[model samples]
Target: MAKVRALDPSKTASSLDTPTDLKPDGVAAVSKALNALLADTFALYLKTKNFHWHVSGPHFRDYHLLLDEQADQIFSTTDDIAERVRKIGGTTLRSIGQIASLQRVVDNNAEFVPPVEMLRELMNDNKAFTANLRKAHELCDKHDDVATASLIENWIDATERRTWFLFEASRAGDNSGH
Candidate 1:
């Protein structure tokens, strides 16, 4: 097996290592914020996956594929968020129960919604997720955690793009006159 190269100790912030450079209370606050954002993103990913599986209508094929791709992106981002939390001396809560109890985003019933409605719901979800990520980025900025903030900015930009695409799709049908 190939040996895994470890991240540079100076750059690899361990969940176990106390942040001696910052006030302890500041570290704890940032950790709490990151955990909340991570769980929320996880919940949004599940909702996206559900929509991908159940969406049906005139645009069913395209919407389904898009949702699947978006869900995969969200899943990948969730992993990054969780790992960053762990790197910042905080636990990444992974259990379903933990995510369910801590997630700020609410789950949607994807099976019953119309295709256009699903797009709307997903857009709303992404907007909410973006808002939360922005808040987390602000908190990270307060603590001088530029690494985590940069990661979050990437996620936020991706989510905004996804949301805009979804909303545009929803509007496309309206402009066509039946």
Candidate 2:
């Protein structure tokens, strides 16, 4: 057998080398916030899709289509969030357990939820998600990670749009107060 060689600690796969000038703490800060946001995004995606699959009543087709569209949008965001972490030399979430641990959004496991209730819950979750995204953007700003911040700006706008659509969908005839 060949002689065993000692591994060099500095060049381990767990520690990635970043091309950017961001310090270690900055990377940690940004990565932590982004991962948390990523977890929440995943949670939101699943919940929206759940509502899409289970939605019923007079507006079934409309709500189903809306939730499907929102789910796709939420799912698309996860990749960007994960890639941003890797771009900054930070490892991202690896498993469902990790996502569950990091996610701030609560799961809805009820056997049945009314279509309007589903829309309202999802709208509230999207609103909270917007706030969380804002917080993450603030952290990115603090770390001067402009790339991440710009991505977050787009996400915030998308989330707000989702919230607006859900809110409008969940209300009665005069929901718009027009």
Candidate 3:
């Protein structure tokens, strides 16, 4: 029940930017794909931020720092993705309204969650994002956009690995107790 500060977007980037090589039609597809990515990334950003703000339990200190790092990384990447959208001749979605309306990632209320529950929820969200990234990369590849595909693929892999690590941490020691 404390005040939470939102990240200032201007400090993150000066303007939207897209790849210069994309053709018009391909740029259109990339634009739409980036829009989808922007939404997903924003949702994940908020989720991580919420976790950072509200997480508590035995793992409070560790999870607190972890969630903060996750939120920072997601915020940076989301800005990059949105800028890429603009570089490809499209505009990045700017409001929570656009993100909430377009994002596929599920948002959870993090007003009061135990640390374990927060980790579980974030693990699930990361898995969902990994899947979404793969699907978007496939579409990018279809448009012969190997650059975008590579970029998304790398992120998907990282997210999947991070989810696995979080999942394992959440499940650790529980078996010994029960």
TM-score against truth, every candidate: 0.84, 0.89, 0.81
lDDT of 3 by residue, 1-178 (tens): 2222333557764354333555667788887878988898888888888888887777778888888887887887876787667655577797889888899888887458777777888899898888888888888887777877878877887788779867876775356642
Ten-residue region with minimum lDDT total, candidate 1: 1-10
- Residue 42 accuracy (lDDT) in model 3: 84
Tens-place lDDT digits, model 1, residues 84-154: 77666666786889888889888885348887888898899889889988898898889887888898889
lDDT of 2 by residue, 1-178 (tens): 2222333567764455555566678889999999999999999999999889998888998999999999999999899999999988788999999999999899999989988899889989999999999998999889888989999999999999999998888874336664
> What lDDT does model 3 reach?
0.77
Query: What are the RMSD figures for all models against the true structure?
Result: 6.6, 6.4, 10.9
True lDDT of residue 157, candidate 1 = 89
Error of 3 at 170 (Å): 0.9
Go through the candidates in order and give each one's C-alpha lDDT: 0.80, 0.88, 0.77
Q: What is the lDDT of residue 151 in candidate 3?
A: 80
The residue pairs found clashing in candidate 2 are: none
Model 1 segments more than 4 A misplaced: 1-15, 18-20, 176-178
Cα displacement (angstroms), candidate 2, residue 163, comes to: 0.3
TM-score-best of 1 and 3: 1
